[model samples]
Target: MNTKFSKLSFTIAVSTAMIASASLASPTVVSFSDATATSTSGSFVADNAIDKNKNTHWEADTDGASITARFGSCQRVDDLVLNWYGTNKYTYSVQLSKNNGATWTTVVSKTSGKGNKNAQNVTDQAANAIKVVGDTDSRLRIDELKVNSLGSTNGCTSSGTSNTSNGENSGTSNPSTGEVSGGNAQYPADVLDLSKWKLTLPISLNSPPNSNKATEIKQPQLKTYTNSEYFRLNAAKNGVLLKAIAGGARTSTNTAYPRSELREMQGDGTESAAWSCTNTDHGMYLEQTLLHTTTKKPEATIGQIHDSKNDLVMVKYVGPSFANGSTDIGKLEARFNNDNITKLLDSTYKIGDPMTIDTAVTSGGNVTVNYKNLRSGVRSSTGTVKMTGIIGSCYFKAGMYIQACSKTDIYNNTNTVCANKNLSANKYETDPYAYAEIEVRKITLR
Candidate 1:
């Protein structure tokens, strides 16, 4: 043979030897089941019980017979053992339920033998009974079947007590109804009885003025009381003197105007201050004018004085040289008692400092006035000062002119004295006058 051929043959032999060594080094077991039965009886037969010799043996057959056991009143059952013999095929299943023979639930199913073992526990909460059903050939056999309860008590009690595997007690009790007067009072709905005391009737506003006269009526009629329980009536405009009535008899009469007492209480309640406009036509205009005039001036002086009896005098006015015309003036002084004025004075003012007015105007044209600066002898310390009144003046004028001249005497005398004096004259004149003024005085503060 050629040398190359011999080398090739040697290589093939070495490869074959390595493959044989690998196959011998490791082995594996493949499991399968063959049908074989040892039990002849169709029920729980002792000869079919599983033992060590029959642990791996089992059977499967066309006949669907089974071995079953009643678990009694147990919530859960487990740890069932099944032993088989010989290499064979077998099918098995476990059934369970809560109701005694009425219903059942399947827990486990398996095939046995054919070199495979048959062993398992049937664990289920509703398993009150178990049925092991299987079929097999003569070569397979069962040696034992064992089972045990899951919990110490094995089942639920009639009183709803269920013991867990960890020894915890899960017991439920009925709920109790609450008591009134130490005993429960039954009511259709959850409610507290409030029938003992009477409820007060709701109060109402006074009747509106001139309900029938459309011209006199200024606003739409509103309910006397927006919320009323005992009696309710729509606003009436017929001037019939309507009232909140019960059983056709008047319970409360409506007034033509709001009661003064209620008006006073309105200050504390949710009701706003009663706005009364003498004439709606000019109401807004007059209100704005009043607000502007009443506004306090900046740089107003304030002072206080004490009498022999120790009573205090307060005075307020514009600066000494300034006139109180229609326009708001600065340097007005407001005075109060020494004690009172001292409290009013803030950190800003010294004895001769000009007083200041803090004025605020609201949307409704309501004006608020505050006076600052209180001095000693120069100004009283306890008094009221306000924009007393407004006096407005307007002026108008027409221009005119007049002229004078003389020439008749000169012409006659000139005729006698050689008529040389020429008589001529010219003149011009003018007149003009115009003025406007307004005055407003301070009113005392109340």
Candidate 2:
């Protein structure tokens, strides 16, 4: 018996297995779904490069045609392959953005970029967008841009059923980094990381210049209310408190969604001060604990999308009904301003209980949503359904996205629809006053 030979065989087997696992976990072309590709040059389009056909190319006579594709949301990019109509005068870089676009980090750069098929295993970066930027002096053309990421099993998505038209980008979006290990790992955090989240308040009803459409009829105004004072949290030294104050008075019959909101920004896309809808591929997720709430027993919205027909689907807590039969109250709840509010999961969850929420579109074109109270082990769910609209994207917003409204606002269309508003306060307070208060200890988004 040659002991050395036996050992060598064993080592080969282990290495082979590891390689196979990695190959199995290779990325697919999810960048194709719900992505917005843009180029500086008008004649040469960025979409041509991502069009899935190598023959179709994006070219520009001018140097620095700089083409970029921003995903529907944030995603993890591990490896990328580029087919270029090269130029010795130009160097190309594979840039990554975690914030919406405020900053960029180059993960792959090449000076020897000319007519070539180049593949690079870039440092795995959780970015919301990727770009093929060329040096200023050199003309550029990209025949194809292929990427293999860490989500889904769509055969690396080079060809065949992997095309986005198939409507089954099963391995497409939803950064599955945390889901790849032993089990769906609980995202860990204790509010010690401020870089992990971003808070949004309707501090001003003024539409963000980048926003695609204005969702409100009028942007509110306030004096003496500081945007810096909205969130109070830093390290564990002082626990994170995301407070939402109902600013301004409801003088209109049109409904308004004028509550403070916090959006998670740690993954995929770069953060921006602009309020445009993020272009994403996989999906968006947010999880937090219900530390506290201080309003009349109104309703609060939770995350989940049932199907394509429905936009902005969230589970609502509708305290009690006054019309005798229409309310979502169970009555064994807690007290917020002395009102008995029905609880999600249980009474304990009403105050300081952990809750997990996920919103992502599966490769199979299904809208997937799930919510759970970590303390009570209770989950809110929509089993399954064929989610339509491939040419669409969604963003996540949390913290008092108040569903409350003036009854007149609903019918007149001045404010957000009544059904769209979740819970409410006894009296939606005025400027410099807080009607809803929720202390969020942890928030994780993938």
Candidate 3:
């Protein structure tokens, strides 16, 4: 007789208990250990933003200024609250970094703000550092900054701390990414030394004159630059990703395929890196995985030893060939004589499988290649190419060089659609999404 009343009572009691539990779950307030600003006004300092006093404020010296705060350790931040000092609108972005300030991940971006206070939810985000970069005709001002963190965390540890005041850690430039020093260099620039390489992008400006040329980055700028589409750190922040699409820009008119690759560079990244394969041991060691290849061709060159005109040796992937009943799919082949290849590396390799490859020319000019599959235990080598003559002025190249291209690719259609003689505004995209990607974990050259 009282069933309905009994159910309503139980529901009320459950709701009350849930509300009580929610009220008991409180967030912890995080404090900053140090703060720095790109520019600061006379009386307003970067520390004022985190001082917990709404009366004191931090003001930027100019537009496009940025302020950074370092936590004692990494933290799982739940939310952030910024109290503005004035009614002036500001366009800004919030970025988080786990490795000091070397790399960053944008968490919140505001193109324009009209309110006096802004709160952003960043739950479960891990970061040891935070930065606020703003652009406005009027200087940006922050009265207070607050962060709500999760429970206690040990956070990420740096490999080594910097002793110099310049903020960069002490170490030799990374061979891969060329990062001078950080906690660790485990991802893209994981080998060789980045100071000795340059990056080539499969993109260019569309406007007249130089539109036909691919973009290249070298030296100091290459050390910290990353392009989201062509080259960037993987999600795990432990590998470098190189991508190329079917209709992207080519390095030159004669090149049909586009590539997001690295070329050997010399001192300070200003000169091309070239050396003779005589009296010196030249080699490159790579740890990488092929992530994708165009559906039509399913082929890409991941590593190469190149001369001025031709690739002497290349680690190429051959997708399953339908003509052969698809038996040739996932084969890792070593290419020589520009076209000749040997499937001695791995006949049954699968995409996303990690592999280690070692290609070298001995001091005596004898070439050698070795391969090992980290997961399947498959291994093979080419021993040496039939060295007819010594190769000189050669350099090492790594990253993705997609072997597929569309008929509209720069090389094929330079007349009609591409006739303006002006560079395409961006990378050509004949087959949108038909692309190749490689995760370069490590690359070492000697």
Cα lDDT computed for each candidate against the true fold: 0.23, 0.38, 0.63
As for TM-score, the candidate ahead, 1 or 2, is: 2
TM-score of each: 0.21, 0.37, 0.54
**For residues 336-394, could you state the per-residue lDDT of candidate 1 as single tens digits?**
33324322323333322333222222222222233423122121111222211212211
- Between prediction 1 and prediction 3, the one with superior lDDT is 3
Query: By TM-score, who's the top model here?
Result: 3
Superposed model 1: Cα runs more than 4 Å off: 1-62, 72-75, 111-116, 121-124, 138-143, 150-446
Candidate 3 regions off by >4 Å? 1-192, 209-211, 322-329, 341-343, 389-392, 410-433
The local lDDT score (0 to 100) that residue 410 gets in candidate 3 is 40
**Relative to the unseen true structure, what is the Cα RMSD of model 1?**
47.2
Over 1-446, each residue of candidate 3 has an lDDT whose tens digit, in order, gives: 01111000000000011233355345556666645555444335555676676776666545676766776667765556665545666677777666666556677788886545676766455667777777777666666666555444555554332111123334444332223343354434432256777998877654542424778888787766788888887775556789987767777766767789999887777899888755555666676888877765678899988876767788899887431212334788888756664646888888878786777675555666777676676657686664333355778899999876665654344423333434443333356446889887556554
**Model 3, global lDDT:** 0.63
Clashes of 3: 14
Model 2 deviation from the true structure expressed as Cα RMSD, one decimal place: 17.8
